[model samples]
Target: MKIAVIDGQGGGLGKTIIEKIRRELGNTVEIFALGTNAYATASMVKAGANDGASGESAICFCCKNVKFHCIIGPIGIICPNSMLGELTPSIAEAVFNADCIKYLIPISKHGLYIPGVQHMQINDFIQEIILELKKKLTH
Candidate 1:
């Protein structure tokens, strides 16, 4: 399976996702790190991404050309001007238009709150993501 983990603003979320995927799934999946900045990409790479790319152009290009089984990241990835405007409209459009399932971690930023998202720690959220991924891959 191929999955892309997109993030920005220090890439802590993406790094954790990549690490969890690597630990739980091992080498069964190819994880791509798509960051809105170089530092974010580097962080994810160090965490265990199979490959990584940075910047809006890189995100657009990869999402457009790669057939990812799923694109996982904060909901900011699809919100234009999110991540302190690091997520441009074009990048958001590209990611939204990609032909893949999107698994977004409902992180409230800029006063944005996802309805029905329970209050939970980051570890709980990551575990939920792992379970979902396992089900998707096995089925």
Candidate 2:
């Protein structure tokens, strides 16, 4: 299955997620790193994404054209002008309007907070996503 792992800024989160997904799932899934900038995309690609793309236009076009099984990223991915303003309104709108399921990592940064998510560790959330994806793939 195709999975889009979107991230912005330094891409630390996407790097971690991509590493875990690689360790857990091996080469079974196709990972596409969608980053807000070239540096972020490069980071994820180094972490083992099968492919990658960057910038607002690339993100919007892919979300609308490609049929990924799911899109995974921070909650800011849907919030316009998020990611410290790296994510543009068009990018956010495209991601939100994409015809695919989205798995959001509850990041309490950028002045955004999600109740019940603040107590969980980042690794825990990544693990949960990997586990759920594994189950779905086996099914």
Candidate 3:
């Protein structure tokens, strides 16, 4: 299975998620680190992603052309102008329209909130995501 981890800013969140995924699934599934900038991509690559790419074009292209089984990242990924304006409108639309399951972490930087999301620690959310991914991959 191939999955993409999308993140912006410093990529700390993506790095943590990728490390946990590596621990849980090893190298069985390909991990693509899709970041909004070079620094973000580098951080995720160092954390254990199989491949990495940065910039709006790369991300938008991947979302459209690459066949990812699923995509994981903060909820902000589908929001244009998110990540302090790093996420562009085209990028958001591409990701939102991608033909893949999206395992989004309910996080927002500019007051966007999912009404049903529970109040849990970030690590807890990541663990839940790992568990769900395991189930999806096995079947």
- Give all TM-scores, in the order shown: 0.95, 0.97, 0.95
Screening candidate 3 with a backbone cut-off below 3 angstroms (N, C-alpha, C), the clashing residue pairs are: none
Top candidate on lDDT is 2
Q: Write the per-residue lDDT of candidate 2 for residues 1-139, one digit (tens) a residue.
A: 8999999999999999999999999999999999999999999999999999999999999999999989999999999999889999999999999998899999987687788787899899999999889988999
Better of 1 and 2 by lDDT: 2
Report lDDT (Cα) of residue 13, candidate 3.
97
**Model 2 error, position 131 (Å):** 1.1
Report the Cα lDDT for residue 44, model 3: 99
| lDDT, candidate 3, 16-132, per-residue tens | 999999999999899999999999999999999999999999999999999999999998899899899998898899999999989888874568766766678788889998898
Model 1: CA > 4 A from native: none
Better of 2 and 3 by TM-score: 2
Ranked by lDDT, the better of candidates 2 and 3 is 2
RMSD of 3: 1.1
Question: Each model's C-alpha lDDT?
Answer: 0.92, 0.94, 0.92
* Model 2 misplaced stretches (Cα beyond 4 Å): none
Ranking by TM-score: 2, 3, 1
Report the CA-based lDDT of candidate 2 relative to the real structure. 0.94
Residue 76 Cα positional deviation in candidate 3, in Å, after optimal superposition:
0.7
- The residue-by-residue lDDT of candidate 1 on 33-131, one tens digit each, is 999999999999999998999999999999999999999999889999999999999999999999998988888785687777767777778789899
